[model samples]
Target: MENSHASPGLLKQANSSALHRALREKGAATRAQLAAATGVSVTTVRALLEEMLRDGEVERTGLGASSGGRRAAQYSLRRDKYYGAAVCITDGQAHGLLVDVHGEIVRAVPLKAGADGLRTPVLAFLDGLFAQRDIRSIGLGLPGVVREGCFWHADKEGGLHSVAVEPALSRRYGVPVVLENDVNAAAIGFARCYETEFPGEDPAETNMAYLHFDRGCVSAGFVAGGRVIRGCGHFAGELGLVPTADGRLLDECLNDPQDGREYTARVLEAAVWVCGILNPRYIALGGPALRRECIGPVNDGLSALLPGPMCPELLYTADIWGDYQIGMAWLTAEKIFHMVQIIKK
Candidate 1:
C-alpha cells in the first residue's frame, strides 16, 4: 500500500501552516529562524516563503543581524491580508471588533440591545462591521452553554437558549464561526495576555482561571495547558449552581447578599473552591457587577484560608468585555489562517 498518512499537498499545507504560525508569533523571522522554529528544512522554508511572498501573505521587512557573514532576509505576516470579526454580549450591549491577523483591533463599535436576547443586536453589529470591511471568520462570546455550533442552554432569563448560533451565522455570512462561553473566552484572553507580557513562558504550560459575576449569575473558567476545560456537559463554569454552606445555592447567596461583607464572603467561597481544584497561577475577578473593592478582600480571604503556596494572585479588571473581544479575535483569526490557501505558481 502507498504511504497514505498524508499526501504531498497535505504535507506542504502543514508545513506552510507551521511557517505561518511561527511568523505570527515571532512577528518576523528569517528563513533559517523559521526553519528552526517550525522544524522544517531550510530549503523547504525558502520555497514556502517565496510562495507566501508572491501571494502577498507575507512581506519582506528588511534583513536580520548577521551572525558571521551576510544577514538573512526577514519576513512577516501581512497584517492586512484578512480581517476577523469578534463580538461579546454584556451589560445590555453588543461590542464588535474588527481585527487583523495579529489580533490587533482595527475598529470597534457598540450597539445597545436587550441583555436577555442578543442575537439580533449582535447580527446588527456584525452587519455594520461587514459594511466597513470584509470579514473572513467570526468569534462570539456568549453567556451560556454552547456545544457543537449550538447554544444549548442559558440562564433562566437568557433568551439565547436552543439557538443554532454557529451554523446560522456561518451560513448567513459564509465564514467559519467559533462560539465560546463568555467566561471561557475571557480566561483565554487573560492567559494569552500573560503569555505576551512574559515572553519565553508558554501559556500551554501555565494554569489560569477567571471568575465572573454578572446578570444574576456566577461563572468561572479554567485554562489548563492553554485550553479551556469545558466539562462533559459544557457546564463546567456554571459556578452559580454550586451549593453554599448556608443551605442555599451559591448564586442565590451571591445575588441576594445582605451587605458588602456577605457578598465578599460569598465570592470568597467560590474563589476558594477554584483554588482547591485548579490552583491556578492567577485568578481574575471580572464582570460588570464585580466591585473593584472586592478584589482586596477576596485576595485576603483566600490567603487566610489557603496556605502561602496554594494561594494564587488575585486581581480585578474592569475591561472584561475587552478581554472577550481579544479572545474572540484570536480564535477567529486561527480559523481564517487555516483556510487561507497558498497556491504555488
Candidate 2:
C-alpha cells in the first residue's frame, strides 16, 4: 500500500507553504522530520527551507546533538520578524495590545471610548505606537454590528440600530484593519485555543461553541467544521435573538421575577433547535455566566430545556480573567495577521 504520509513532487509552492506552517508551530524542525510531517520530498523540503531562510522567515538554530555524523545545523522560524497591534472595544472602553507571532502581549494601553475623542485618541495612539515599538498590522473587534468598518445594530426592524465604525478606525490605523463583532472575536479566540492544542488534527472533525455574557448584552459564537461562519455583514452567531414562546429572547425575558424560568426554557428550546441543525460534538460555555460558583443551575437548565438527542453536556472554563484579556489581544492580532489575509495565501 502507498504510504499515507507521503507525497510526489507536490508543487514547489505547496511544499514551501507547508514548511512555513510547520516551522511556525514547531519552532525548530530538521529537514528529515519536516519531510515526514509534510509528506513532501526531502529535496523539496530543503529547497523550501532555503527559500524561507533567504526571505528572513526561518533561521538556523545554532547546532543540535550529533549522531555518528557531522553535527547538522538545526533550524527554526524567525517569528520576531513580524508583530501586530490588536484593539478590542466593548460598551465604551477600548483597550490595545501589542501581540507577537506566539500570541504574547508585548504592550497594552487602555483608552476610554468617548463622544469626541474616540477617533483622535486611537489615531494618536497608533501614530505613537510606531514611535514606541514596531507593528506590522492592526486588528480590531467592535462591541456591536460592523459594516464597511463601522458599528451598527438593530432589532427586527431598522429603527433601533447602531451606526457604522470601520472607516474611521481603518483610516486612523493605516495598517490593514479587520473589524469583527466582539462576541465573534471572542469565539475566534476560543476556536484558536482548540486549534493550537490539536495541531495535526483536522479541527473540522469537532464542533465547539463559546457563549460570552458581557456587561450590557450577551452573545455567542458557534464553530463548525473548523471555521467560524460570520454570516452576512460579519454577524452570524447571535444567541440573544433565539426565539421564545411569547416572541421574546432569553435575555429580554429577564423582566419579571419568574422570567429566569421562561428564559431557561427558551434557551433549552433553542439548544434543541441547534442540535437538530448541527449535532455538535462538544458545547463549551465561557464568559461571565461561568463565574457563578455552582454552574449546576446552568447545566440543569440546559438539560431540562433540551431534548435527549440534543442535550450535550455543558462544560465551563470561567478562567476568562487571563483568557479574556489575552484572548482579546490574540484575537485582534490573529485577525490582523493570521486571518484571511495570511491564511488564504
Candidate 3:
C-alpha cells in the first residue's frame, strides 16, 4: 500500500521510481516538470534527483527549452550503464531480452519451452537464459493468474502456486525477480506505447484494456491513471474466468486452434461479449492467432455490430505476435529491478 506519510526509505524508493518514470516519458525532464508530474515538491525532487545523480541513477543533460525565464537543467537516465533482463513465458514459447533503461529492446533471444507439455524443461530453460545474461534484475510474465504476489500454474504437481518465480529462480542466481502476469506486462507495454503515441494529463485516455488472443487466450493488463490496475493479489486483468456459457476464455482459445471460419466466429463472439461489458477506447490484440490476415473478417463483422460507437481499432503486429518472449524478458527485468530496490533497503 502507498501512504501519503511513507517511511523515509519508502519515500526515497517511491521518488526514485517516479523519477525513472518521468525520465522515460520524454527521455529528459526538468525539476519542475518532474515535480508536477509526480506531485512531489520541487525541493523534494531536487533532493531526490541529487541523490540519484550521486548513485549514477540519473545523468544531467543540457538545458531545457526556454520558458518565460532562465532555462532549467534537464536530466535523463544513463541507459547503457543499466540493463534489465526479462522473461515472457507464454503457454507456447519462451523469450528472453536485455533492455536498456529506456525500455527499448536491446537484445532479443527466443527459447524453446515445454516441448513435451511439461514444466521441468521450461523451468530449466528459463534458468539457463538468465545465466547467460548475468543480469542484475529480472521480470517474468507468466500465463496464469498472479495473486497476492503469488502465481498459480501447472507443474509436476498439478496447480502449483508460483508468485516468487524470480525469487525462486534468484535462489540460483542470487538476484531480485518480479513475476507478473503476461497480460499485465503486455498491458504495461501497451500503456507505455500508447502514452508515447498520445501525450496526456487526463487519466481516461490512459485507462484502457489490452487483450492477447492465442490458442488459450489472456488479457494481460488494464490501466487507469497511467498505472496498472492491480487488484488485490495483482489479479486485475484475469478475464479468463469471466462466466460464459461456451467456456471461451484466453487460455482456452490458445490451446484449441480451430478452422479459420470457426476461429473467426468464436473471436467475433468474443468481441461482441467484450463490447457489451468493457466498451474500451481501443482493443489491443496479440498472441499467436491475431495475425494481420486473421483479424480482417472479424474486424469487418465487429465494425458492422456497432455504428456510432467507434469499434476499437485492433493492433496485431509481429511484436505482439512473435516477440512475446522478448516482452516477457523485459517484464522480468522490470520485476528484478523493483525487487532489488525493495530488498536493498
Candidate 4:
C-alpha cells in the first residue's frame, strides 16, 4: 500500500507518524514496545522519541513495569501540544469543532446553512477557533464525493459541487487541508469511538461497514484494516443510486412506512451483498429514521435474509453527527503530524 503521489520527504515524516500513532493507540509505551508496534528499529524509535520529547510532541510518562531486568521509560503523546479544527457540512447546517491532539473535542458549534453557502460560515468558524489556539490543520467532511480536495454531488441545496475545498482552505490557513466524504468520515469516527469505548477490541484488525440512511438517501463507508476504502474514483459507498425492488430507486422507499418491509428488505439485501463482497465483522446503521425501535426488526430481517454463516452483527450509531466531528478531528491531527499534503486532481 504505497502512495505513489507521496513525496520521499512526506514518506519520511510518515515514520514519525507511525510511531506517534502507536504511542497514541497504546496510550503509553516503552521504546521497545513502540519499535515492535511500529515495525521500526529500536534505535530509530529512540531517536524519534528524543526528537518528539524535545519538540513537545511526546513526553516521558513514567517507567514501565520491571521485566525481570530494567524498567523501561514509558512515553506518551503530549495531547495538549497542538490543536486542529474540523468542519462537517450537512444539508441544513455546518458543524465545527476544535480538537486537541488527543482526539478530544475542546469546543463545538453549529452554523446554519445560509444563502451565501457553507464555505463562508465554515471559514469564519474555523478562523475564530484558530485564533484561540495553535491549529496545525483543518479537516472538512463534506456531504458529497470528495476527490483530491474537490467537492461534488453534494446535497441538492448545499451548493457544494465541484468546489475547490482543500485549496481554498489550505491557502487561507497556510496549512494542510483534508477533505473527506461525510459518511466515510463518520465511519472513521465511529471506529475510533468504538475502539476508545472498548479498548480491548482492535477495530483496526477487523472489517467494518458503516451504513447511513439519511433523508431518503443511503450511503455506506467501508473500513478494512483500519483504512477507509475510497475506491478508484473515491465513490465507494454511493448506495442511494442503487435500485430497489419494484424498480424504484432506494431513496424512493425511504419515506414510505407502508413499504417498510420492502425498504428494510432491500437494505438487508444490500447488507448481505456487502457481507459477501467485503465479509465485514460488523455493520453499523445510522440516521434519524433508523431509530432504536427499528433495530430489532432490522436485525430480525437481516437474520432472515442472511444465512447463519453469512450473518454479521448489526448495530446502530445514534450520534453519527458526533462521529463525523471526531473523524474530522482525527484526520486533521493526521495531516498535522504526518505532513499529509493535499493532492490536486
Assess every candidate by TM-score.
0.89, 0.74, 0.72, 0.86
Q: After superposition, how far is residue 125 of candidate 4 from its true place, in Å?
A: 2.1
lDDT string, candidate 2, 59-147, tens digits:
89876577888776677866676667777766566777777765677877897655685666666677777676556677776767676
**Each model's Cα RMSD:** 4.3, 6.1, 5.4, 4.1
| Candidate 1 segments whose C-alpha is farther than 4 A from its true place | 1-4, 114-121, 124-134, 154-161, 339-345
Q: Show where candidate 3 strays beyond 4 Å.
A: 1-17, 112-136, 155-164, 170-175, 199-204, 207-209, 216-263, 290-294, 321-345
Q: Which 10 successive residues of model 2 have the least lDDT summed? A: 336-345
Q: By TM-score, how accurate is candidate 4? A: 0.86
Q: Predict model 3's lDDT versus the native.
A: 0.65
Candidate 3 positional error at 325, Å: 5.4
Best by TM-score: 1
Winner by lDDT between candidate 4 and candidate 3 = 4
Ranking of models by lDDT: 1, 4, 3, 2
TM-score rank order? 1, 4, 2, 3
| lDDT for each residue of candidate 3 in 1-345, tens digit (9 for 90 to 100) | 233446677778777777676676568989999999887789999998898899887899999999789999998887766666766666666666676776677776666645465256545654665566545666667777776546777677666656555446668666666667777777666655665577763434465567665544445466655566777766666555554446655457545756787667666666666666666666676665564565888888888987657477766645663344444544543543441123332
Clash totals, every prediction: 0, 11, 33, 0
Using alpha carbons, what is the TM-score of model 2?
0.74
lDDT by residue for model 4 over 30-74, one digit each (tens)? 999998987778988888889989998898888999979989999
* Backbone-clash count (model 3): 33
